[model samples]
Target: MDSIPNQQHAWVNLRRGEPAEALEYRADWPVSKNLEPGEALVKVHAAALNPAGYKLMKFLPNFVANRPLGDQVFGWVRSDHMRLTNQGALCQYAKVREDWIAYAPSNIPLDEVAGFAIVGITAHDMTVKNADLQAGQRIFVNGGSTSVGAIAIQIAKSRGVHVTASASAKNEAFVRRQGADEFVDYTTVSLPEFLWQRAEEGRKFDYIFEMAGVTDPSMYTQSDSYLSPMGFYATVGPQPKGLYLSEIWNLMKTTLFWHLPRVLGGPKAPFKLVCLDYQREDLEQLQRYISEGAVKPIVDSTYNFKDTLQAYERLMNGKIAGKVIVKVNIEDN
Candidate 1:
């Protein structure tokens, strides 16, 4: 049997109890814990980075917040927990639940699966559950190259829904190749006006998936003007403002100003903030999607496990075509 270490390397949040700007980067730290039922040993290979980590200190409903926190990447078969704690995936070894894991497909590289875990499940939830999209309908996705948006575009398209998306000019071809039927270069064309023009032409989308990264608030608040009469608008990943209570205040303010009005009979249209629930069923579905070639992981870059902080900084910077990952046992995988 392969030997497992009682103490392993990890990145401890030195900034614990401090404010948001207080970053955590100290590595080579120690982590020791025991395994429980439905849990087994795992040697992490690669881990993906997402903005979801910013919510480390924030609150989530228990049903949607079960995973241990990090490690939404590929590792040796072991367990199935995702709502990981702050000192999460960056560790060398983990005791994960068996149900939390889905075996890697032989056709794809182990390192690549790192980016698919969270974004894939989130996109599936948004397109399939929240929006309840149907074939032949139209949909719009902002930040087409973003981790979530990229997957969302493909998921909706696989069901025969027409997809329109906005991205930087440089990423137009990349997004188009990812299955967008119509590509809007946001740098050259104003997104709202472009959509509004289509609305004027009697073309409206049945579903709109907002993946954050859009700066104009009016685009969201005034979507009803361009949305179909009975359409759904859903979002995930709140863009954090300041490091302190600013993040909390932003959520409250959005709920009060945007979501509440849309739900209770204001002018903003039917809207919601969507989240992902980890399930073995979803992972099995993801495996099927991969086997069918309807979706594939898009990796923007990779960093050594020692450079985990640099990887996080790159993800936090918010400029990339796809997912950024940290390679733990990179030399092998």
Candidate 2:
């Protein structure tokens, strides 16, 4: 390993906007070395992009954002999601709390494992914790091709749950490869109507995992028809791209429906927004799955650290089937 430097290169967010507009690459950025008692400094080899990274960049300003400098990436350090710290993974050095760290699977490389923390744990949270699925039960994942959705499909399938997931027709094969038993071409029909039709045909899901950052509430509001009586609807959250009227209207409707009582016309099924909390056990479980090949890491594309903005562009374009990685330690990759 190379000697740790006082200053290192990083992608810093200047203002809230798209990645291209909000981020600047600075070589003089100081490495965060002041560690709290349990924190460890890691020399990042690679980092992976997630939709939440750009979404936060576009929605929040620098001062209040936990990851003000760049997107969170898993790297040479163990696969754990870092939070409430200035040390983001887009830089060469990141400070991660000891509780968040887990041993990387010996079978995978740094770049591939770099995308594991967020998506993997999120899938585990949705499939194992929130929904509490069981063998022979059925689940519907709204965004099968998404990083989280892909992992969720595999996790559910590994537990013997039947998975029906959605993506564009082009990604049907890709989604199915992740162990989805059924695939829905989301572009072919209105999702709510399609789900209703499925329900009418006697097909109901034990749980619905909305991994897509959908702002529209109709699919969830109308979930009573497709969701089993005791089943629940889980979502990453209602993520709006911007403050457009349509987005705002959907957000408002989502909030209203979320709080509305069933007696007052809310859906009969339960709804929950899956928020990921860092847990050592959860991280270890995911690592175990990786080691067992139950959960596989998929990298959509990779770029040098210099082209991180380009990597973000690919991520925000919304067509990727897997994680977009950036090689931070150029020589190591």
List residue ranges in candidate 2 displaced over 4 A: 58-85
Task: Please provide, for model 2 over 117-174, each residue's C-alpha lDDT reduced to its tens digit, 9 standing for 90 to 100.
Answer: 7788889999998877789998999999989999999999889998889999999999
Tens-digit lDDT track of model 1 for 1-333: 125545666544454432235445444455435666777546677776666454452211110111234333342221223435334665666555567666665567767777787778889898886777789999999888888899999888899999999888888889998899998988888777888898998888887788864433556666787899888667875666565675666566556656455456555576667866667778777767877888898888988867766776776676787877777663543
RMSD of each: 5.6, 5.1
Clashing pairs in 2: none
Error of 2 at 313 (Å): 1.3
Task: Tell me the deviation in Å of residue 151 in model 1.
Answer: 0.5
Q: In model 1, which regions exceed 4 Å deviation? A: 16-33, 54-87, 213-215, 241-253, 257-265, 330-333
TM-score computed on alpha carbons, candidate 1: 0.81
| TM-score for each model | 0.81, 0.88
Compare the candidates by lDDT and give the number of the best one.
Answer: 2
